[model samples]
Target: MSKTWFITGASKGFGREWAEAALERGDNVAGTARNLDDVQELVDSHPDTFLPLQLDVTDRSADIDAVRKAHEKFGVLDVVVNNAGFGHFGMVEELTEDEVRAQLETNFFGALWVTQAALPIMREQGSGHIIQVSSIGGISAFPTVGAYHASKWALEGLSQSLSQEVAGFGIHVTLIEPGGYSTDWSGPSAKRSDEIDAYSAVREEAAKRPSANDPGKPEATRSAILKVVDAENPPLRIFFGKAPLGIAERDYESRLQTWREWQPVSEEAHGS
Candidate 1:
């Protein structure tokens, strides 16, 4: 059966690729971007199946309207991809309150709002899938991109809780933790804060992680998301790419070690 998809950030990167993939497979897609022109070709080619929506997801009301329109057009949305977010690059001190708020507004709260907007439709329909595009930064943090890390980390937590909350409604939530994709996410989509000289040495090293130019083709992620939505029982979280496992392993192991080391002190507070 052909499913309908509502994807944010559909102008480029995984969002665009996913939209293209879905349409090629004879599915319908309503792709949202800041400018509809970016996705005009798809809309032009698949006039009946592709919907190009000009949207800024940071606005909760706009998100609500877009979701409502998509549901009205498609009748029922089988998948909702919250992929409208950009990378915020900077150390914790380098980022201002406003900058952090902006980053959260788009990356964290935007997804939350979209989820809120879609839940009613999904709940009413009795089945749906919500794909949250998180990053390896969500699971592990780096020096230069603290703001980005914080945003993704919050998203991860939010989606986890959402998954539990919506399970009774047959609504599935999947957190996609993709590593270094050659997507425009780090290029035209990324925002940078003013550099602080104190963090320059580590900042230079952190810059080597990944970006739109280095992440490489995102075909695998596009494929994975499709499989997730189509599955009868999708996993709560799916981490993409090879690097994620290594980073996750190290981070978890280090955390475990610290927990074990502090167990005695931690238990002392219990007053047993």
Candidate 2:
């Protein structure tokens, strides 16, 4: 069966790759970018199967309208990928109010609005897959990108709850927690806060981390995404690259150890 996909940030990175892969496999795709020109080639290459939409996902109205337009064109939205977000780089103290809000507006709220817009349609159809393009940072935090971490972490919690809420309706929610990818996420597309002198050493330390330079190829993820969306029972959360498993294993072990160490205190606090 040919599926229909509505993908945000379809201009580049994983969005573009996934959109192209889907269209190539004869699925219908309504792909959105802030500028239609960015996705013009998709339309040119797959005229019958591609609909390019101009969208800024941060705007709630825009998100709703884009979803409506996609459903109107495709008749069904089998997969909805919220892939429009940029990385913000800074220490917590170096982040400005505007930067923090902007990060949340696009990374967290944008996905939320799109999910809200798509839910009614999916509920009506009684089936759909919602893919939230989160990051390894969503699970494990680092020093310099605190604001970015906050946004993805918020998304992680939101999607976990959403998975439970929408399961009865035959809708599936999956968080795509990708490790570092060779995308422009940390290049031109990244937003950076003003650096503070105190955090310079912290930034240097972050740069030396083992995963800092080892990014998976963006093209390598297309097959994984296709498999995920097509699965009879998709995972609630899946990692797109090699690095996230190790990170999760190490982080969760530490977290579990801490909780166990503090279990008595936690139980004591609950007592009368």
Q: Quantify all predictions' global Cα lDDT against the true fold.
A: 0.89, 0.94
| Candidate 2 residue-wise lDDT, 1-272, digit = tens | 99999999999999999999999999999999998999989999999899999999999998999999999998998999999999999889888999999999999999999999999999999999999999999999988888999999999999999999999999999999999888999899999988899878888988887765788999999899999999999999899888899999999999999999999999999997
Q: How many residue pairs clash in each candidate?
A: 3, 0
Which one wins on lDDT? 2
Task: For residues 97-169, write the lDDT of model 1, one tens digit per residue.
Answer: 9999999999999899998999999999899999999988898988878888989999999899999999999
Clashing pairs in 1: 181-215, 182-215, 182-216
Native-referenced Cα lDDT, model 1: 0.89
TM-score winner among the candidates? 2
TM-scores of the candidates in the order shown: 0.96, 0.98
Residue 194 in candidate 2, Cα distance off native in Å: 0.9
Predictions: Cα RMSD each: 1.6, 0.8
